[model samples]
Target: MSAAPLTYTPLDPSGFEELAAARPDVVIPIEQTPAWIGFERALGRTPLGIWAYRDAAGTLVATASFVHVTRRFRESVVVINGPVWFAERTPAAERLLMDTVREQFREHPAVDPLYVRMQVATPQAPATGPIEHGWYEREIVVDLTPGEAELLRSFRPNARNSIRRAQRNGVEVKHIPREEWKEVFATQLFPIMQETAARDGFQAFDSSYYETLLTVLGDHLRLLVAYRDGTALSWLITTEYRGYSVYYFAGSTLEARSTFAPYLLLWEAFRVLKAAGNTACGLTGIASENYPGLANVTTFKRNFSKNVVVVPTTYDIPLDPVRYTAVASILAARRKAPAAARAAARRATGLARRVGRGRGAVGASRHS
Candidate 1:
């Protein structure tokens, strides 16, 4: 009448696929893992992954992974992203895994102030234990079960108008073949992304990383290109996760903005999701608070659906509160310095260019 003991193992890259398939609810897809891995690689960081196994009477009952974030400023938190366990073993397995992770984290000085962030896609919140609590995170979800006409009617007036204008203006939208799209994206979108990142003060992934993703996800990933009068205007990359399709990335030319090519591209993506029998679409990563231009972005997304779910921004549980705060403040300051420098550089460059142009004009007039 004794309970069975639990076992823990370090999850290797090879084992992830099989484990993920065994328990879909608790596991994120293989494609998602690569994206995260690619993110870490690009940033020059590595995360630790620990897998939990429960066996009762020599029979395997459950499995889960404890993922620890490894970064210079944010090294203390170990996020338990997508832990999978069988339905029958939920309570016991969850408790055991949680306890083990807490103990493990306590022993390691590197992992102080440990916290696990888990996202359940359903509208209803999951039960939380003594160690865990729920926080609000928002996402704009569009129900795709309805026909195209119904879907269009569900949109707000502005969204509908934009869609109409895009259609009327003859902005053609279609899926680009993966191989061909890769080439086009590398040549056309990469430079735009680099410029945007430079202006916005962030880093962007290299083209090879995106190409790898498109190759792995295949049909589940789509590249929607918007064109007007035989000229490419904008493009959007979408990925399907579970029953929902997400608008992952998009890029548009300055010319495209005048014709509202992005509006047409998004409408086409939604239509494609509906046609493919997806249940919903996710307008991902729109900031809800404390950022300029975020409100405009949020408002634009809100027009498409009534179900606006806000996701919690990234959280931190500091181990050394005093030290952590000091480091965090320093990092924040570092992030701002680049933007200020970029702004100053731009102004100086503009002034120099204007002065040079005036001198050139004056010289030409004198010669004439």
Candidate 2:
């Protein structure tokens, strides 16, 4: 018999969940989940979804969900960690899926997006296909299959020592229950997040964004906080699905640095997630050439595991090349502004210190 033809159809959250459930071996990204779609909706992003299936067998083979965003009258569709394939994925199929999505979006009356940007998030290695890869990144995956002793042995000496120190210092890691999520975020998580952002010179999402994530993802998401002497020192938010967990978001206090709470916090996360039946935990998006600003956090993550994986880079399908270029340039500048500003501030401070020292030297010479 001839093979069943591939068919494309509109997909809803329930349909996407069914496809995810059917594919056990594939690592379906947390960002591609139905809960994430709900979170995006809560954040006011319009959703666009599609699925590819076998016509004869009615089996889902692929799924992609995108958020339609408009800024300054320029529209864009963004797919983060998605356009996932459940079956054998060929370059041709990948091209076809993207082509179909582009056509659908173009035909839709409500949307006239300048481009569609898809950031590859999969267990597969980087592709050598027509999808011109950009924004390359490194991700570290910790194998939770090993015993605690073996796990500890895999880490860098500093990480191992820090974990031990935190333990000795009486740092306690707590898994916040669902009922306490609202209270926890309002009182603890959001405040710590703001402080981290201010110290690190990055923007933090609003409280509602996290609240929606915690509420919608429910059991799939775990918020683990490290406490020292009854004071919250560090926190990690991880999402679990199909025996895998993603180290999603985190924040640490200055006390966490001195107390080594972050190290113990991650170690505890590994134990808790492993005990919850997860085989691996992904310390998502480490520092890379494309994202050098993450160097500090990357140093911290490398302490735990060296099982680095190269994820496929993002690709853009420009519907209107001219407008896409214009808008892309604007967006890129907007993204870099904060980093540039921080660098400028540092330079200014250094110059001020040098001038002060020069004046002091002249004053010492006059006294002499």
Candidate 3:
């Protein structure tokens, strides 16, 4: 039988949510959710719209949400962890979805994107024609279906021992209410994040970004803090949608190392998410050649589960050939130059810090 013709159409919030709910077993990526649109806006990106492909029979087949990011001289539309498929997905359907979205952006009155970068959510073979772009090469997801005891037993012996040691040290993990986020970020989470960034050699986002994220995501977000002797030791942020949860953001203090507070915090997170009926929790991305910054945390996360998941690579579709090619060339040179300079600066800064007493300094790789 021939498939019914599919038409590209705007998807309202209610329809988007209903289609997402249709696949209860599949965990929808937070980037493709309606809430993500608000998040992009909060981050100063231009929200295009959420769209879907519907068949003649009116069944929604696939959907995606787009956000326009204008960075300095470059402008591009980004689709992270989408376009989502609600029915059996094929290359033809995927191609049609991508083509139609590009058309939509081209016809958009407000902006003309230099290119569109799409990171497909489904794991099927990637569609052809778009230039392949890659971000975090792999991620780790843990199954929460097993009973709590079994879940705890599944972790590496080291991870299990750390959790136990944290408990023995009188460490406690607690969830902070949304009403208290601002103050907590200022007093606890931000300081811990700074410490973690310094120890790990990375720059942390400003507190305003997290404040806005908590404000916008609201109940869909959760903050878990590990405490020992009435002092904050470690903290984690997670976001839940449908039946899926993600280990969104996290940090710890030097004091947390001895107590193993992060370990207990993760164990408690598993129990809390399972109790809330989430069947899977994405530990987000792991260490990869392209993103070696994750090395430290990846080793930490791997002690919990080894279910490494390889996600689809991103594809870039050029809308304006002239500008796209020019920008691509400039970006290639720009990337190498800045990276070398930054590495040198970091080394000098690290040495200076050792000599004296100085201090300094999302998407899949972004948040991970």
Each model's Cα RMSD: 9.3, 5.7, 10.2
Whose TM-score is greatest here? 3
- lDDT by residue (32-145, candidate 1, tens digit) is 454455444444444555354555554444444434554465554434334444545344454554455445555765555424444333312121221223232466888899
Candidate numbers sorted by lDDT from highest down: 3, 2, 1
In the predicted model 1, the residue pairs found to clash are: 137-310, 137-311, 137-312, 138-309, 138-310, 138-311, 139-309
- The lDDT values for all models are 0.63, 0.79, 0.81
lDDT of 2: 0.79
Comparison by TM-score, 1 against 3, better one: 3
What tens digits encode model 2's per-residue C-alpha lDDT throughout 208-229? 8888888878868899999988
- TM-scores for all predictions: 0.65, 0.82, 0.84
For model 3 the local lDDT of residue 171 reads 98
In model 3, the clashing pairs are 362-366, 362-367
* Model 2 bad stretches (over 4 Å): 1-6, 53-61, 120-136, 329-368
Residue 1's lDDT within candidate 3 is 61
**Model 2 CA lDDT for position 201:** 86
